[model samples]
Target: MQQSSGWRGSADIWLQAAYENLIESGVDAVRIQPLAKQLKLSRTSFYWFFKDREELLSALLAQWREKNTGNLVKQAERYGESIIESVLNVFDCWLDQDLFDTHFEFAVRSWALQSNDVKAQISEADEIRLAALRSMFLRFGFEGEAADVRARTVYLTQIGYISMKSREDLAIRMKRIPEYVRIFTGKSPEQRDLLRFYARHNYTQEPYEK
Candidate 1:
């Protein structure tokens, strides 16, 4: 029995499979049998990694917190020449999948609708993200209420996009970024700063209205 449990897939593999299922079909679909069948491993292999389904779900939540909330805070804390640049740094999270997984976030949020515990975690994550953005504004000399409102504006807009599964052409989105920075930070980014931001996203040509 012990050898059977140890014979096959590793914990990461199971967890990854759980993540895929959770994102693709929601959390309820992230079961041991489905994952075992998907991985073509015996059910015993699942126990080698997780004690049960609840444990696996907890791991998924941890990963989400680490990747989504963690990256936003880090980006908000990244060195930027001005508030515009700092706002742009936060914008990178919206564009870059490696920095933030929108689909995964959406999935978890949907799961939250069905679970009180998940809903509480979602609220906690929201607070953490909002606090980070508030600090970013505060660091740039935005005073109290102004900082709070601006932070809410920035974070809520991104969350709205995620929740609604909004899509925009990359070029169109790039063209709007400067205006977004201005709106979010009350200052337009310099041409040089915009150029650097564009280059980071491999947007070579100058943005244009279409």
Candidate 2:
């Protein structure tokens, strides 16, 4: 019953569909048959691209590592004249979906809870990302325990957002960016930087007054 002439789904297509399914329904629901049906293709196409379900899952994990971890490292390396600038730079990750895949982060962390291998990888990811943030703090004159604490404040807040499945509006989250910056850096974000943030986002609604 397999069509030898019709177009077949590419590897990227299968992976993307699988990734979305993982985000929406967790890893267990990412089956070849279901995805083939979703993609409107025969299930055999999956085998043409991925050797097996385990290989597809591994590919998903690799994608997550390349995207989430890679971006964190890149953000931490972006030049900042002062700590505030650097903090804002990192803030972009949360604001821009392309830079930070929080949903994917949530999915992977959920997957980690089920698999020991995944849990270890998640732990290593946490350390790598945490260390990246910690270095940012250290570079800005924060030293010793102080740097580590501030970095944790910043990194942990983001983790908490993912863990709690936060659904706050963009403008609302934007409004609190300053306070977050202040808490993490112990230095208030300059008015200009805040303005830049608003301008970059083109937000009409203001963050609620504290």
Candidate 3:
């Protein structure tokens, strides 16, 4: 059991190293020898935790789903009654300019094309996240096709912004997100402005409500 625990820890270290490297340099930059070197472990250590590079990639996809996709869905469900707040919260989570980089987006897109397994994983993760967002929109009074389209619009807008990777460009694009949301829910400009400010600044400060 102790040996199993040690192997699990090693696997986690490798996954973290791989994720960081992918975020920095793109998925093509990830390889087992380099990862082993980064972790200061023998290549044999990788075999203890994974069967091969494919297995490691699979694990990486699973981790991404758990942290990035799954957690955001959970957060949306928690705040589902307030559609604007829930959507903004998900955006705020993604606005970590340092961690969520273009390379990370590149990795996901590239892998989806190269690996059928990865494509399936990405599809499943997206469905779960989008369903959560759609449910939130429905709760806030959007109906059937309207809720679905709004949810997809918000989701795709976020992916498009991240793919662009320029803070200035994202800022310009983000300014219009509130208007889009309002179109779906009939929120007034003042209400949309409050949500927009909160999403951008990641704050719920008293000044925003006024």
Quick one: best lDDT, which candidate? 1
- Global CA lDDT computed for model 1: 0.89
Q: For residues 1-210, what per-residue lDDT tens digits would candidate 3 score against the true structure?
A: 012445334667777888888777767767999988777778887777788887777777777766677666766776534666666566654665342434565578667787787788778877987898788888888898988988888777777766675455445545655665566455633566465555566555442231
* TM-score-superior candidate, 2 or 3: 2
lDDT of 1 by residue, 17-91 (tens): 989998889988999998888999999778867788998899899999999999999999999879988888988
Q: What TM-score quantifies how close candidate 3 is to the native fold? A: 0.76
Query: In the order shown, what is each candidate's alpha-carbon RMSD?
Result: 2.8, 3.4, 4.2
Shift in Å, residue 170, candidate 3:
9.0
Model 1 residue 55 lDDT score: 87
Task: For each candidate in the order shown, give its overall lDDT on alpha carbons.
Answer: 0.89, 0.85, 0.68
Model 2, residue 113: C-alpha shift (Å): 1.4
List TM-scores for all candidates, in order: 0.95, 0.92, 0.76
Ranking by lDDT: 1, 2, 3
The segments of candidate 2 whose C-alpha lies over 4 angstroms from its true place after superposition are: 1-6, 204-210
Clashing residue pairs, candidate 3?
none
Which residue pairs show backbone clashes in model 1?
none
Task: Output the worst ten-in-a-row residue range by lDDT, candidate 1.
Answer: 1-10
